[model samples]
Target: MTTTDMLTGALAAAARGWHVFPLLPSTKRPARPNHRERDCTGTDPRCRAGHTGWDARATTDQTRIRRAWSSNNPSYGIGIACGPSGLVVVDLDTHKPGTEIPEPWNRFGIRTGEDVLDHLAGARGGTITPTYTVRTPSGGTHLYYTAPEGVRYGNTAGTIGWLVDTRAHGGYVVAPPTTIGSSSYVVTDDRPAAPLPLFLLDLLKPQRHTTSAAAPKRFDARTDRVPAYVASAIKGEVAKVTSAGAKQHNHRLLCAAIALGQLVAGGVLDERTAYDALTDAARVLMARGCDCTPIEVDRTIRSGFHIGSRNPRTPGTTRDNSRKAA
Candidate 1:
């Protein structure tokens, strides 16, 4: 994407009062490096000034966005800080070729993140309240809603369901028209964001501590969404495995396996696809001088993946922690 294209999209969001920042060129990772407090060398350029993270540094000023992403600088992608934007975005996602929705969701034939949200909304005796929305490149959606005044909701991971997530306080989202490879996030609905409905707002609140998993306070059985963002991650991780040094060969492959496992649990990628990809990468790495054999690699992947499935995850997406699933 061109700097001009990014600038225009950033301006559009900022004009709507959504604070924006620079993501890395073609990535969701922030362009603004997060300075570590422990390494605050006070004099180092990266840490010389008081540390200002992406969320804190995000702005609504058109000039700031333009200057940061102009021709003189990298043609950075756009990130909208959800909290500052006063938005609570329901991130509905699709699944990868090799993943399946978990437990209860799968039992109900629920596949996408959108389906989960819709099912819950129906259970709550309500319909989805449409607002400003962004559609991610992988067929997922970002349903933007106005946050309630004075409530700071943080990011969540599968707390809503198998593939659904939310982005709020302490989180950011890749804004529309930000390209990654050939695809880009684009605005599907440019209308003003609707105020978050009470039902959903309540879901984002502190859920009561319970002995057992509790059904969300106001959910029904009408969910209709899914999630899928593993395309680049798989390719990247596999590439890493194939290029890893001897000291990190097995470790890198294991890590990649575990990461893919988390996505499998999150319904973002299928188990078989994740396994085969890792196995193939491992075999290639082995052929390239690493001593690891196919059997050993398979076992390593399985072990790491088992550990990861317990905790579902999202990658480079706006993750919201709504109430935990029952």
Candidate 2:
């Protein structure tokens, strides 16, 4: 088999364990449904019913707020991808207003079963620790982390993720996809100071919801036509991973590859051959040591709409609850 074929085969093999789905080539049809055109409702109880874009989470205008996390995929033994808007919690054990801790904020206490890691670094007046922060397409921020094992993913309750009693509930087994510090998640290459040292005091002060940013004029999902800024950011990430020889799980690489594939299908690719490019990129990322279970890869690519740039997540958005799946 060709190198691409060999890599694809290997990725397929690894996916069987992790639950990753392959990025299938779309039929070249003139009227394919836009992945962005569907409502998240009905998929799960926590899905914001009737909401199409990011602003559906809003009740009023000035109420917009956003949350950040200490780190991504904080598992110790098993590695998890902590997918797009990983911080947002969708399930909250059916909590109500005034009871809801805001989805993302509650995940620490709920899913991972610990207080959120403060991202602030060096505030202790000692040596600083490296920090990375990245903005998601939903206008939310994802703080990746390296945490102990027992944290996991679940599809119980018809949601993609929910905190199930790992010992008793007997649902999906979730684990970190790689080692902490080595594979937590990528924030910005800017390496902002870890925010944990400063915010670690209250443990719940920082809010997880943010108002959606106004849609940019002339937005395009085409890989080539992607907003210059977004394109630059993606390129920068690619460069950072490549230059540092960063390794991730197959799930992460697959999510990224599928994202590129969808973008290509949407006419965003500079090159017309998005399927081949995606497969090739997956191979390259895998070659670089990015690792993930096939299950994780499959799960991520099938759920690529979450990677969209226009649909910003809101603080207290229904999806932010830990009761919801990741």
TM-score of each: 0.61, 0.20
lDDT of 1 by residue, 193-250 (tens): 8666434754778652111122212211122222324666677678877788878887
Backbone clash numbers for all candidates listed: 33, 75
lDDT value for candidate 1? 0.72
Which residue ranges in model 1 land beyond 4 Å of their true spot?
A: 34-37, 43-49, 206-326
lDDT by residue (248-272, candidate 2, tens digit) is 4433443443344333223233212
Give the number of the best model, judged by TM-score.
1
